[model samples]
Target: MLCIEDLLTLELFKTLPRNRLDWICDRSQILNLSTDEILVSEGDPARGFFIMLSGRMGLTRRSDGMEMPIGQHEAPSFFGEIPILTGDPNPVTVRALTDCHLYQLSSEDFLTLLHECRNFEQVIFKTVAKRSRGLESFIRNREKMAALGTLAAGLAHELNNPAAALVRALRDITPALLELQRMNLVYGQHQVDAEHTAQWIKARDEGYETITHKRIDPMKLSDREDELLDWLEDYGVEDAWKLAGPLAEGGTAIATLEELTARWQDDQTKMGTMGLRWLALSFEVMSMISSGLRGAERIAELVQSMKSYSHLDQGARQLVDIHEGLEDTLRLFSYKIKNGVEIRRSYSPDIPKIWAYGSELNQVWTNLIDNAIDAMNEKGILEIVTTPYSDRIEVQITDSGSGIPQEIKSRIFEPFFTTKAVGKGSGLGLEVVRRIVEIRHQGSITVDSQPGKTQFTICLPIG
Candidate 1:
């Protein structure tokens, strides 16, 4: 238990009226944390404030996905009071810097404490307001550095493309290098005459092109080289080397090219199974480039969506189609959905659009759809239906799979409480969805869950 009087010595709790202080003292619970335990994470819903009782805690900001410590709080300082006041997700993650004890008052309990203790509420709000302003300023400065993240996801593709080409170019070198080694080995061992070896080299050189192209007509190639050599002799050329430059030095380069081109003029399939393999690798590289571009494009689009969805560009809200927002959002998630799911839409063809922050509402759709897809375990049917009411448009996203567990449904929208395996989810999604719906669109969201089905509903008021 945390007594208001005991915490009052802390600057953050000092201003509460004695009665108000006692009210807070009555509701707070004490929790113990082991070293390295996570207290709060970035984007987690702010449940209430925490006062570190007897150990160190770290505030970590996730930038470039590196959890750099932004600050540290020692015993007697409170945290999370800022986001609780502003209704935004907690932007910093707080983890135990050492084995520690903490006093926690959940947001639900805080409401009752707040109603009973105006003085305590005022102290918390005043302290958090100053912190909020500072955080806002920090956020603006950090936003600039975020461009590096954008460039990284974008420009990193430059490396992937060249890296993929190198993989192919290396594959082609294997046989050629081996053949060269065999040549030197045989000749160095005195196994053949220089003239015989030169002829063998010439034949091997011709075969390099033929077999690579899998043409392999040894006699035909020998006869063609002979015919070409004979023609050069008719023009008073003797040495094959002496005639080489003149043949190529004149327009005969084009004639040789024409001869080679005629041989290779067969369709790509003429290389038989070998050609199919080469084509497969070539297409694979092309696919890597395409997928990388798509990933980079998606990151850029998310930044755009983030900027537009907030629409700080212009302050006033206006009429927008929720489905249009959902449709565009769906495009961004095409890869995730297309991998293993069937989507069904039963939208009312004529529902009126609602007035709200269009992009923010799109996030609501995105978050819901993301959860619905996850609920299906990435495989099953997803159904979306739009219905018009007297004053609101109701949208339902449903999935066929295991549903939310009953024991934890009440806390599903609470921040940091996710059933997802570590690293895959942060548990902030539904909480963000709740805020976007209630705060931005003045809408309502609810969920109905069962063993093989889970449906999330969104109702946005019409203008």
Candidate 2:
């Protein structure tokens, strides 16, 4: 339960009208959280204010592979105070380090109360000062980390081409080895006896000739064996004595060296591709991956998709087909969706291309569809319908899952506003999506909701 004193102590509301303050306190609720429970997290939009009623609360920040503790507010203190003071997206995460009881004030009601009173402005100013210090520290640290991230990302991008080539090269090796193996068998069959092998040799050569004519000799087997052995040694094949007789008898032994070399070459290509991918991601988001488990490719890809979707590097917009951007984003998120969801796609034929930002638009689609899949827990129906809207195209993304609450529908577009569990969402996703659509693309997105039915309709001018 919220007490009048809690609202009374905060500087932001010191000047609020007594009646409005009373109204806010009356409406506020006390939420008791168990140990390790999250109260609020980074990227969740500023709701109102979270004041610690009792117990301890901790703020954690991710910096350079370390989870550094930022600030801990004990009972009678407030957290997420900065967002309420600044009315911006909350950048720091607040969690209950121990069992805690917190009084959550509605941003709307709190602001209404603040406006009605003038006596407490001084107190509000003081509290804002306290919270601002902590926020400044968090930002300073984050910016520094982001810088290191840029250098690393550039390095990753520079390495991508080689890696891509390696993966591509490996893909072609399977067929090459198969062709070589067939040649080996033909040579082995002719190795049995010289006179008896002549007819077999002629037939084998003719067969090989018909298929681009590669020659092999059963008698020249000695030379081939020497060549094969040298190649194997180069490939680290140490157990040659035992491998020799069978290989000589079957003529297919040389294929192992080829297979090993192919795999090795392929691995090089794959690893190189990863670096290039990270580099590409950095180009989009500009060092968003300086922190987190980037050693794991998931974080890298997340950074990549985020960067691509943001279009941070360029503000310019051009004509784009939302469907194309949507498809590209889907490829990025397919792994996550595949875990349990059966995706249903319904793209309209000849989806008119609209003027838009190619990458940022990708993010909007990615965030929306990703959320839909999550809403369904990766199962249930997800339909993306596109129809011509005279001068624009309208997209209706509906899912068979829990729908948004009517009360929170408006808040969903607010920056950092989220309804997901801690670590599961930044709450900034939809906020960013809406930003790109409305502000950047000069488009509109609306939502309608009911049980198991929520539709996000986006309209973008095609001309």
Task: Give the RMSD in angstroms, all C-alphas superposed, for model 2.
Answer: 15.4
Superposed Cα deviation of residue 309, candidate 2 (Å): 6.6
- Model 1 residue 111 CA deviation (Å) reads 17
- Candidate 1 per-residue lDDT over residues 255-371, each given as its tens digit: 433333343345452322222122223323333344445555655665554454445476567677666677656655655677798999998988986678775676677677777
The TM-score values for the models, in the order shown, are: 0.46, 0.46
TM-score of 2: 0.46
Worst 10 residues of 1 by lDDT: 271-280
Give residue 311's lDDT in candidate 1 (0 to 100).
52
Residue 183 in model 1: shift from native, Å?
A: 42
Candidate 2 residue spans exceeding 4 A from truth: 1-315
